[model samples]
Target: MRATLIYGLGDVRVEDVPDPVIESPTDAVIRVVLSCICGGDLHSYHSWTDSNPKRMGHEVIGVVEDTGADVRRLKKGDLVLAPFTYQDGTCSFCRAGHTTSCLHGGYWSRFDGGQGEAVRIPLADTSLFRLPVGGDSELLPSLLTLADVYGTGFHAAVKGGVTEGSRVTVIGDGAVGLLAVLSAQQLGAEQIILMGRHCARTDLGRTFGATDVVAERGAEGVTRVRELTDGLGTEIVLEAVGHMPAYEQAIGVARSDGTIARVGVPQYEQAPVGNASLFGRNITLTGGVAHVAGYVERLMPAILDGTVNPGLVFDRTIGLDEMAAGYRAMDARESLKVLLRP
Candidate 1:
């Protein structure tokens, strides 16, 4: 089997690797159906340190080819979505909705990642969500988004307290941030504002329920948010860009008593949070690595019903062999997301 191997920054190679087999009674082997690149993958694609040759992706969906004896919830020939983090499902934290931090939390890049032909899933019963057999086949890419991006987006809005008629602003227009906008609207937000500059993305955001679009990039962007909210800032702000500037901007655009949900994956060595700047403002800071496990079931119905096409974020699609082009398209921002078929 061929798997994507990361030899260094900006370096990805499709090398023949040994096939994976069940190594645990709780494991299952999946024939990857579809996979895609994520913003997090870009971190490894551009970073010098994350360049260590290793398996590279954490988002994917597939068909079960085999399952271990302990895997009672799934069987061979089932279609399923694999959570990026594997959990036992009975752990205290898993029951508490923190699957990302499960007692047995681990990363998987099937074969090398979901980008491969097959993958061995650990903690099978707990980590895999089997999709209905007769469901919409065209929905796989969108359903695939639920494996990570959609789940993360839902977490961003839920953490930010998006309730019926709440005023919300999503700080990043990347796939996750864009989906956050959709999640907010789906939850009944009356006024949804999207902060972004790209024409295609801003258009997509509007389709997803962005009532207003702010094209400004920096401090000017902050001013726009304040102006939109009558200087009170938005009631709920989602920090989806995992950068210092994006972090501060989320804080800057939020109202004095607003809540800022930080969902962006940080790559920086240090982040500066000023005490005085946030102290007197009554701003509530929330959000972190998303609890994706809590979202799969909650989002499955909506996605299966076509209430959300998170797959719209996938601006391009390619074969697993075109992995390099997929990376280039995302890195150039020429595409918002890319789906890979093995």
Candidate 2:
């Protein structure tokens, strides 16, 4: 099997690797139907210093080829989408609805990789969601988005307390951020503001429900967000960019007593948060690794029925062998999102 491996910063390759086999009684082997490059994957690819080759994908939709003896919720031929973090449905956290932080689930960082031709899914019953047998092909891309990007975006909005008539500001314009724009609008935000410099992405955001686009760089961006909200700042701010600057922008644009959901995968080990600033502003902050379980299930029906189409964010598509090119396209910001057929 050919899988994507990240050897070091600015280095990614497709190399032949042994095919994954069922290793647990609860395991299921899936043949990758479609996968894609994520902005988070690019962050890890660019930041690591060591030449450690590991599997690279976390978002995937595939057909079940085999299943472990104990797997009952899925069988061969079922097409499923899985959250990047695997979980045992029986775990206390999972039962409580925090599948991503399931005590029995492996920390996402410990996994070998998800960007490969095939993968062994552990805890199949808990992690996989089977799509309708005759689901819409046009909806596959949006369903795939639920596996991660859209899920994260929805989490950002929901976590930030977005609701009907709320003023919302999305702090990034990447795929997740674009989806956040859509999620916010779908959730009934009265006004949605997106902050980014890229014309293409900002345009996409507008199409996805962003009511206002702010192209001003850095601090000016925060000003524009405040201006859109009549100087009160937005009621809810979604921080989808996992970088220091984006985090600051989220915090800056959030109104006093408002909420900021930080969904961006943080790039640095230590990010300074000023208690005094937060204290003075009295802003509520909530977010972490997204709780994708319930959100995926809730959003799937909308996607399948075409109520929401997150697939519009996919600007490019390629084959498994063109994995490196996919990464480059994302790194250069030439593509909003890349979908690969395996």
The residue pairs that clash in candidate 2, if any, are 55-113, 57-114, 57-115
Candidate 1: list runs displaced more than 4 Å.
50-52, 110-112, 134-136
Lowest summed lDDT window (length 10), candidate 1: 105-114
lDDT of 1 by residue, 88-203 (tens): 77778889988878888666653347778888889998889988744349888888888889889999999999999999989888999899999999999999889988889989
lDDT of 2 at 212: 92
Per-residue lDDT value at 37 in model 2:
87
Q: What is the C-alpha local distance difference test score of each model?
A: 0.85, 0.84
Model 1 / residue 119 / CA error / Å: 1.0
- Compute the lDDT of residue 269 as modeled in candidate 1: 55
